[model samples]
Target chain A: MKQQYGIKDIAKMLNISVSTVSRALRDAYDVNPETRKKVLELTEKLNFKPNKNAAALASGSTKNIGVVIPFITNYYFSTVISGIQEEAYKQGYNIILFVTNDDLDREKTLLRNIATTSLDGLLISISSNSDTQDHFEQLMEEGVPMVFFDRVPHHIHVSKIMQSDFDGAFMATSHLIDNGYKKIAHIAGPKELNFTQERMNGYLAALENANLPRNDDYIIFSGFSQANGYTDTVTLLSLPEKPDAIFAVNDRKAVGSIQALKANHVQVGLEFGVIGFTNDPIATVIEPNLTTVEEPAFEIGKQSCSLLIKHIKNKNHEPHDILLPGKLVIRQSVKLSQDS
Target chain B: MKQQYGIKDIAKMLNISVSTVSRALRDAYDVNPETRKKVLELTEKLNFKPNKNAAALASGSTKNIGVVIPFITNYYFSTVISGIQEEAYKQGYNIILFVTNDDLDREKTLLRNIATTSLDGLLISISSNSDTQDHFEQLMEEGVPMVFFDRVPHHIHVSKIMQSDFDGAFMATSHLIDNGYKKIAHIAGPKELNFTQERMNGYLAALENANLPRNDDYIIFSGFSQANGYTDTVTLLSLPEKPDAIFAVNDRKAVGSIQALKANHVQVGLEFGVIGFTNDPIATVIEPNLTTVEEPAFEIGKQSCSLLIKHIKNKNHEPHDILLPGKLVIRQSVKLSQDS
Candidate 1:
């Protein structure tokens, strides 16, 4: 590695005191504009980087944010990241990503080893099975500003931003009922996930209001994978009393259920109805299209980051929860009846 | 904000010298087991984290790797990241991501601002239109360890890992010919990318081997998006002499072309054939189940990271060129004449 130039070296090169060079770089009013311009130009030309340790020690700020998420390979999460990136870029902050792969052990290890000294704040979406909030509470106690989004903890008194999962689910389930589908099945994500429970509650409420009999067998807890969707749908189809409609927790599962139905040579649009959450791009590509509730993933990201930065700047800021509403997008997947 | 604990606090708490505490944490042989155990217990209890900057200053290693990519929302890139994350986790390293959005200017700025002091090595996939590589050359000259994957620069003599684009393209073209497709069209990505040129070359070589006349007009240099594929396919269809087969650069574009064909009421499998690269999950959801070349994205990521780490450890190691072969996945998008 090349020898890194330090502030002392730059001071000697420019024939200035170390204190003066530092003040100039920090844009202190005590330094003349001409001197500040020269110092910046020289640093830019030499690609000189200030030692982050010394800077952090003096300023007590790292200008770095940590973002912990379960995964990043999906459209919803990726789009949310884009939104976060936009806000962070505007505020001149850098984001460091940590993925837990939805494993509680990994999440614990990550939190335990996180270098809070180097992070100004944190934005997280807890893993599916993250039942304990001790680690998060500990971080908050340490005055590390934190904000949660999407799949967040239920009882944490931190700033959180998420879509209206319950309302979205109710709309999806109600859509099925309005379309004249009496027997509807719901394919859900892991029961441990907070959003899954919220969505399930909405499904139940919609069924209750419609005065339709709720069958416990119609609600299945599966993974978020397409294969999970297929297997769950197959299991539902094999039941003694099969439902005429299916409500998937997310678009991937919905696509999988559709594929399973098509493979079994069962007419989808006419004989069966399906709806999904998260209006992923695949929803449009699937045959007969998919009717889905569009979650405001990007907005959640932008708002969460913006809120976290506020907490970082002012530690005493009050925590708030922001819930964006979801919209129902109708397509060919569900058949409309005269009752509508 | 809560005051962060330092080694001085730990030393005061244990009634020991700060140097002894640091040494014990570093697992130096000079420290006794009892002292080491005491230091570990206190550090763990207090959740004390050694300042990464100070540790890096002493050891000349940061345990951080930088990953520069053009995009992350696509299936191939996301899966590759999963592989990289798996290996990185095992090796006790953290990855810092830098996205350029396929803009050459953004790539230049990001590389220019990269802090070599904060990173042990870099893994990069250059933007499509990165015509100048001076920034990369400067980093190499400064002895920064770096490995390029996928969209690598041709002028750089560094280690590179990528799929066997040439061979994969040849197989795709040959498959079309074997299925009785005499006239074939190629919808390619940006001409500036190395992989695009390699794939195009493979297509040309296959046509030459079969003694078929190669029409320059049949090959179009578009983009790597679905909209590009749709528009390009529409243009091809409008031509007086349209090709019977199309080979898209990726799955998204292939789906777009299929949508275009279906909109025009063309018979997909019999009257026309479509094939795509990168066997994304969407391939199955689309009508007729797209036939594609499955790129080993995860393997590429793992191998690239492993190789980069090796080079970081030993600067004198010879550069390696790794080419992983892709598999031909047969599906309904392309039908053999014999089967018909």
Candidate 2:
């Protein structure tokens, strides 16, 4: 029969503790460099291949964080994942990715079927449905630390990191108004999303402060897609009272709006103004370049993962909500008003 | 141990083999609907978890496939992931993602640290470095069901899925030549990449077929990035004899080339011509809409994942190589020659 060896065996051989060997194995920053070097040399000499799962089971420290997202095909989500990956790599941790495809049923089954025993913690941006909140709550009850980013549940008392959606919307609307555009409309995301409602409130607040009449017909709720933005803009254009400017929930929708305007032979920057949130790369590619407020997608991802790791390390850590601000990026989309 | 109830108990209740019960639990397609329903009902009643690692150890099936990619922030890679995710979902498999950030050292460490015991198979797009092929060959020798995709390793007899790079490049270069651009320079990806060399060959072949002088100075090899395209274009434009057209390796680079041309007051699609491979969405957004050869990114992803799953199911399965064709998508970047 063959005998098995592990970090503990190496620790005993080196007159060290198992925790020291584990930290050295994970390449943790706190470990002394000389001790780490010694551990590595010994492990290499012994040809030790650590069984990640076995080590995780024994110590309840997996050095892995599970990230559950809705979609990765989009610019924002993928960029966010890049940020998360960067931070995870720097911290000597690995992330496992799960996609829900934005279906609540799949979201539910995925959560329910998750091997929580294997995961040290979780980071999730859910399907954005209130009904699925219970599944998240169940995960929390299991003592698995978690942090929600971007699309988060409203009433959960957990760590969360998000971009400043309302402030960015306010900035976009004010920029359009400042550019001498009066008849303004907004293309919003699905109404149920927390950010959607917050952004809508900011837009409305900006309009009310400027004493502009609010027309119910000016607000359109649709999916966060370019096609939705295009269709919504078309609907707005066909109205008897055409808007002079449009504030979009996202850049993709804004791109769609610009395309619809171009297809109709409408001069975009010279006449109709468009301001979008989330300065996607396509913002620069579109003609008359899109004016946008850049969402802190990467920062949000980094902060969320960083926060989740803190919670995992200390169970009693207090939950906090983080709202990173967004900044307006000036471009060619909005017309230059002659007067300030 | 309380006579530990598990999948075996469920199998006994349904008068089925344990493998059938496991298949039903995994939501495999061939399982009977009635049998699956019964199995689900019994499992639900028992509150069974079937601890993933334990079940995998018992049956030698983890039902998880690991995917190792370089970057997901780009359009092609993200779209490929979408295809992989769709196919994985349909086939009742979960994908574990690992990104190497295009670093050879990181790639080596990641591949070495992979928990092979917990994974059913592997899907990899190598970092396009010859040095890392040894790590892959070691995995293959260990009998790990694996498939290489897109950025494949050379000198390895393994199942692989990639777009027809040489054919696509030929189409791109020939289209430029046919449009009356005699001095066409190509800004290509890193020299070590398989696709980069293949694309370069196609460009050389097109020039040879047209009886145009092939200048060694016409080819510039650099990183796969927009910045690379911009800098390379700047160098070409500054040359004593500037090329009349530019064919870039990818759409982002094509967009960069167009931007550089337009910045220098060189009218694109009129005075100068540009063409690209990989008709990314940015192709439409870029001014003068890039003419390109669209790679079958999504198809390659789906085929690779599907092939890996077949290998996982049967270790002795024959390995195959697939090369899906790319099609030319004409928009406005290429100039219309008057004589032709």
Candidate 3:
């Protein structure tokens, strides 16, 4: 490897003092314009990048924000990351990405070893299996400025940004009931996730308001995958009395439900209705384009990052929560009757 | 904000030298057992962290890798990142993410400001419109090891990892030909991307092998999006000599093509066939179940990151290219004919 040139070497080469070189590099007024220009030219020519560690140590700012996400393979998470990246870029901050793969153990290890010294702040979405909040509490105790987004812990007293999951679920379920589907089933995500619980409650509330029986057997707890949704739908279809309509936690699961229905020779949009949350791009591709709740994933990311920067700059700032509402997008998936 | 504690403060608390404190934190044998235990206890209690900048200055290793990508709001890229994250975590390295959004200016600016001082290595995928190699040359000259993956620049002298795009395209085209499709149109990505050219070459080769004419008008250049695919397919259908089959660059575009066919009241699987590259999860959601080529995206990410780390460790190591083969996944999108 070639020898790296530091500011000291540049000072020596220019026959200038070390402090003068540092000041000139920092654009301090103590250095002459000619000397500053010489240092800049030489550094640019040599591609001499000052060690970020040393600069961060001296300035007490690393210009790096850590983003910890549960998963990245889904559309919502990926779009959120894009939004975060845009905000971070405009603010001259780089993002350090850490994915827990929705594993509790990995999340614990990741948070434990996170180099807080090299980060200005942290943006996190808790894992589904993170039943205990010890890891987050520890980081908070250490005074690491962090903002949670999307799948956040309910008990955490930090700034949080998320879509109105409850409202979205209510709207989806109500839309089905209004379309003359009294028997509705819900394919939900892991029960441990807070959003899943909220969505379930919303489903129950909608059924209650419609004067329909709340059948526990109509709900299925599974993973956030198409396979899970397909299996759950198959199980529901096997029941003595099956649901007239199905509401999925996400679009992927809804797609799987539709596939399951088609495989069983059931007519979608006519006989068995289906609705999905998170209006992913796949919604349009599916036959009888799925009706869904449009989640503001990108906006959540942009707002979370923007808020985190504010917290990073002002330590005394009070933490708050921001909940963006989801919009109902009616498509061909659910059929509407002439009567209310 | 509370006063951030460092190794110096921990050493003072434990009544030890800064070097001994650092060595103890690093689990070095030179430190006494009792003193090391005391240092660890104090540091843990105070949440004191070693200055990454200072440590990098003393030892050239930062234990950080930079990942430069074109886009993230897609299944392929996001899944690739998941693979990269898995490997990076196992290797005990942190990943810094930079997104170019497939824009040439963003790519250039990102490369220009990339701080080599804080990163041990870099893993990159060049943007489609990136025509300049000067920024990459600058990084290479600075002795910062980097490895390119997927959409890489042709002129760079670095370890590059990518899937066998040509073979995938050839197989897709050949499958269409075998299914009695004489006139096939291709929806290609941007013309500047090397992968696009390679895919086009494969498409042309498959036609020549089948003794079919390669129509220049059959190929359309556009961005990698479902909307682009839809518009391109519409344009192709408007021609006097319409194609019997359409091979899209990706599954998103393939879905778009299918939608266009459906809108035009054309029988997709029976009359007009559609095959796609990158067997994205959406393939199953689309009606007729898209037949496509599955690229080894995860393997590409893992191999690219591993190679980058090796280069970072051994500066004199020769750069090599890795091209993993893709497989054809048969589904219901194309019609099957019994020949044997």
| Top candidate (DockQ) | 3
Candidate 3 chain A — worst ten consecutive residues by lDDT sum? A22-31
State the lDDT of candidate 2 residue by residue for B1-340, as single tens digits.
1115677888888889998987777677899999988887887667565666555555667667888999998989988888887788778777878899888877877776676766789999878564558878877876889998889887899999999899999999999899889999999998989889989998999999999999877899998777788889998999999999999999999999999998999999988999999999889888899999999988888888899989988888999989999999999999877764
- TM-score, structure 1 vs. true: 0.90
Each model's TM-score for chain A is 0.88, 0.95, 0.88
Model 2, A181-230: lDDT tens per residue?
99999999989999899999989999988999899899999999899999
What residue pairs are clashing in model 3? A53-B53
Q: How well is each residue in A175-225 modelled by candidate 3, as lDDT tens digits? A: 999999999999999999999998998898999999999988899999989
Q: What is the interface RMSD of each candidate, in Å?
A: 3.1, 3.0, 3.1
Judged by DockQ cut-offs, the docking class of candidate 3 is medium
Show where candidate 3 strays beyond 4 Å: A1-50, B1-50
lDDT of 1 by residue, A1-340 (tens): 5547888888998999988887676555678889887887887787786665556656778667888989988988888877887687566566777889989888987886677776789999999999899989988877889999999998988898989999999999999999999999999999988999999999999999999989999999989988999999999999999999999999999999999999898888789999999999999999889999999988888899999999999989999988899999999899888768
**Residue B7 lDDT in candidate 2:** 76
CA lDDT of each candidate?
0.87, 0.86, 0.88
Candidate 1 residue-wise lDDT at B77 = 85
Best by TM-score: 2
Better of 1 and 3 by lDDT: 3
lDDT of 3: 0.88
How displaced is residue A162 in candidate 3, in Å?
Answer: 1.1
DockQ of each: 0.43, 0.48, 0.53
